[model samples]
Target: MERPTRIGVQLAPQHAPMQATIDAARRLEDMGVDAVFGWDHFFPLSGDPEGVHFESTTQLAAWAVATERVQIGPLVFCNSYRNPDLLADVARTIDHISGGRFVFGIGSGWFERDYIDYGYDFGTVGTRLDALAEALPRIRARWDQLNPPPLGRMPILIGGKGERKTLPLVARHGDIWHSFVGPDELSQKLDVLRGHCEAIGRDVAEIEISNGASVRDGIGGVGFERLDALHAAGTRLLTIPLSGDDGPDGYALDRVPAFLEWRDRKNG
Candidate 1:
């Protein structure tokens, strides 16, 4: 039998007070969403470039205590931000904090401002992906050596749609593959991922597929509907990102009901 489809939400880091962000996550968990995600980036991705934004891992630690039940993770952590070993250690710590309810979502670094301001080398895309490729095994190795092992083997989530480098890396290391493109694009990518899995001798079904939901008018769009299409296409995990710092006017909370309604229907 097919697993019931799952719904995940990316609570965007920009524009909200920290406590409000925590509150929102709790509310989502209360409403029975499958997972709650936050992205890893030092700077804002949209809205005012200089707007207030929360950092990923710190907020993840907060989420560990703030909510129970929902799996929590960075939608994709920038592998360039921390050394691979350190990233693994941090993930392990959060795993313990959440009593193993953690997914280590990661990807090659992007966002030039994060690099330049933080004094990390901002290399070309090829170089960054090369770094990530090197880091994956090292991170896994270090996780094994930690004095106290993680509660369960924490799942690794690899985000991105890069065919040659990213998908192959996903094939080798990921438990979940996250991408933002639509169904048709997702179908093609999955084919590529499957081929990579075959090359590596890994069963394609071992990896979960997830995508970002597109929102419009605070009511709907491809966000939830894509779950059905993605499910039909063998992509069961779905994520919708809410720009958390949308101000006291509570624009971000407006979408919660739609998410809840969709989830309730799925559960029903």
Candidate 2:
């Protein structure tokens, strides 16, 4: 089935206190976002080098309980930090807590600081992708073996733009593929994803397309032209980044409603 257009807010879990993120998640849901995502990282991706930051899994559990309607998960949890089976169980627990509103968004690890500081081996990009390749099946197998499986479908959202390893992985495993590219390049990327799906005998339609958009791009910064084009190209989900330092609250979600309104119109 074709997925409806969705507006997702990626609440950056950095610089602000934990409560700010929690509060933002709650309010973002109230604001009518379809999903709320947090990033998996040990330190701030931007801003202060040693600023306040929270862990993704813990925050996701709290978000699962704090909201009633929206889906929750990391933008892309790094596959390096946790064991595959253990990660499966943790995600299943959160899925139950969310009443089955969780989306498992994952990616091969990339942040060097997160690895170096945490004592994880900072391997080459190729090695990390190989590890992720090895982990996906193990994670799925463990999910099947769990005493209580994930609450619902627990759709897996794989995030990346690399045409080689990443796109192939998405074609084989993702229910939703989150791409970092914008409208101008989306068509070309989708072509690559489709080719991979064809090679694997997977129906390209089964994997929902998700792309990152500047709030302005969707809400009025440039205009909805780009968003319109993306929708035409088959992207059903759009995630806009929220800065912790944008305002008093880490969310900076003022523009969310407008984008959501756009989504409603598109879906309607």
Number of the top TM-score candidate: 2
Residues 86-130, model 2: lDDT tens digits:
999999999999999999999998999999999999899899998
Scored against the true structure, residue 241 in model 1 reaches a CA lDDT of: 73
Which runs in model 1 stand beyond 4 Å of their true positions?
Answer: 217-227, 263-268
Query: Which stretches of candidate 2 lie above 4 Å from their native place?
Result: 218-221
Query: Best-fitting candidate, measured by lDDT?
Result: 2
Candidate 1 weakest lDDT stretch, 10 residues: 216-225
- Candidate 2 lDDT (Cα, 0 to 1): 0.89
Task: For candidate 2, list the clashing residue pairs, or say none.
Answer: 216-221
